[model samples]
Target chain A: MEWIRFFITAALLIMGMISFISAVIGVYRFGFVMNRMHAAGIGDTLGLLCVVSAMAVASGLNMDTLKLLFLIFFMWFTSPVSTHFLSQVEYYTNRERARFMTFRKGGEPRES
Target chain B: MNIDQAYHLLFMGALIIFAVLIGIMLIRAVIGPRITDRILSINMIGTMTICSIAILSGLLHEGYLTDVALIYAMLSFVAVLILAVMYIPAKSTRGQKQSRPEMADTAKEKKLQQSQSGETTRQKARKKGKKA
Candidate 1:
C-alpha cells in the first residue's frame, strides 16, 4: 500500500538523520584530529547509505534511483581514500605527533 | 494523512535537521585546531549537503538534482585530495639526503656515529637512545 511505502521511507530517513546527528556530536566532542575523523567517517558511510536508500525507496524504479545508487557507490569508494590521505597529511605535517604517539627507529614503539 | 502530505512532512523535517547539522559542522570547521580538521569538517558538510539535495530531488520531483548530487560527490573528493596534496611535503622540501623511510633510518644511524667535539651530553644520550 501507499501508506506502507511512505512509512518505510520515513523510517529510513529519520534513522539516517539520527546517525548524522550523533556523528556531528562526535565531531564536536572528540579531542584530537584522529578522533574527530573517526566520528566523521560514520556520517560519510552509514549516514549516507541510510539517507540514499531512503531516497531510492521513495523514488521507486527509475533512472534517478540508478543515479542515487551510483552516488552512494562512488562515495563508498572515495571516502576511504580521502581518509587515508588525511591521515598521511597528519603524519607528515605534525612535528609534535611524537608527544602523542611513539615511533621507534626499528620494530619497537618508542615511549614518548 | 495522504501519502503526499506525509512525504512532504518527512522531507521538511529532514531538511531542517540537515540544516542544523550543517551549521554545527561549520562551527567545527571554524574552531578546528588543524588544517586536516577543517578539511574533515568540510568533507562531512559536503556529504550532508548531498543528502539534502537528494531529499530535495524526491520532494521537488526534479530528477536532475540526483545528477547534481553525483557531481557534488566527485567534486568533494577532488577537493579533499587537492587539499591533502598541499599538506604533504615534497621530496625536496626538507633538503635532506634521505629519500624515503629506509634511507632516512640509515641516515639517522650514520649521524649517530659522528658525534662532534661540541656535542652536549643530553644530545649524546638522545642519539644513543635513538640507535636502540
Candidate 2:
C-alpha cells in the first residue's frame, strides 16, 4: 500500500511537470500577445491544476492538503475571468501587432 | 538523502522553476508596449505566485501559505479589473489626443487618410457595380 501511494504521487508529479513545460513552450512559441494569453490560460488553469492536484495527493489528507485544494479552487475560478478581461483589453487597445510572426486576417495576409 | 527526502527536494525544485517563470513574466510586464500587455503579464505573474505559494506551503508543512495564496488571488482579480476599466479610454482619448500634434506633421496620418478615402471610393464603386 505504501509503494502504491508512492507510485501514485510520483505519477502525479511527473504529469504536473509535463503540463508546466508545455505552457512555457506555448508562451515562447505563440505568435501574438493575445495568442500568448491563450497559451497562458491553458498553462495557468489546466497545467497548474494537474500539478497542484499531484502535490495535494503527495501531501496526503492534512491541513496542507486542504490549503492546496483551496488554491486549486481559487485558480479554477479566477484564471478564466482574468484571461477574459485581459483579452478584451488587448482587442480594444489595438495592440495586436505580431512581433514574431505575421498572421493573416480573413484569408489574406495584411500588407503592411 | 533517503527517497523520502528526495521527494521534498524535488518539490522545492519545482517551486524554484515556478518562481523563475514568474520572473520572466515580470520582465514582460515591464517591457510591454501597451497597457493591456502590462496588465496581462502582471495578472499572469500573480497567478503563478499563488501557485508557488501553495507549493511552498506543501513543502514546508506550513498552513500560513494557504492564507497568503487566497489573498494574492483576490488582489490579482481586483487589480486586473481596475486596470481593464482604466485601459479603455485612457489609450483611445488621451493617447490619441496627445499624439495628434506629432501626427499632424507626420506622413503616416496623411497616408492613412488617403487609404481611408480610397476605401470609401472602392465601396461606392462596388455598390455601383452590383446595381448595374
Top lDDT model: 1
Per-residue lDDT for A31-83 in model 2, tens only?
56777787777777876677778767767887867877787887788778777
Give per-residue CA lDDT, model 1, range A1-112, as digits (tens): 8788888998899889989999999998888888888999999999999999999999999999899999999999999999999987876766556444444433223111
- Mind giving the per-residue lDDT tens digits that candidate 1 earns over B1-132? 677888899999999999989998999899888888999999999999999999999999999999999999999999999999887765443555564432113333324433322454555788899999
Model 2: CA > 4 A from native: A95-112, B89-132
| Model-by-model DockQ, in order | 0.51, 0.36
C-alpha root-mean-square deviation, candidate 1: 6.8
Interface RMSD of each: 6.6, 6.4
**Lowest-scoring 10 consecutive residues by lDDT in candidate 1 chain B?**
B101-110
lDDT, candidates in the order shown:
0.84, 0.67
- By TM-score, the best candidate is 1
Please give me the DockQ of candidate 1 compared with the native complex: 0.51
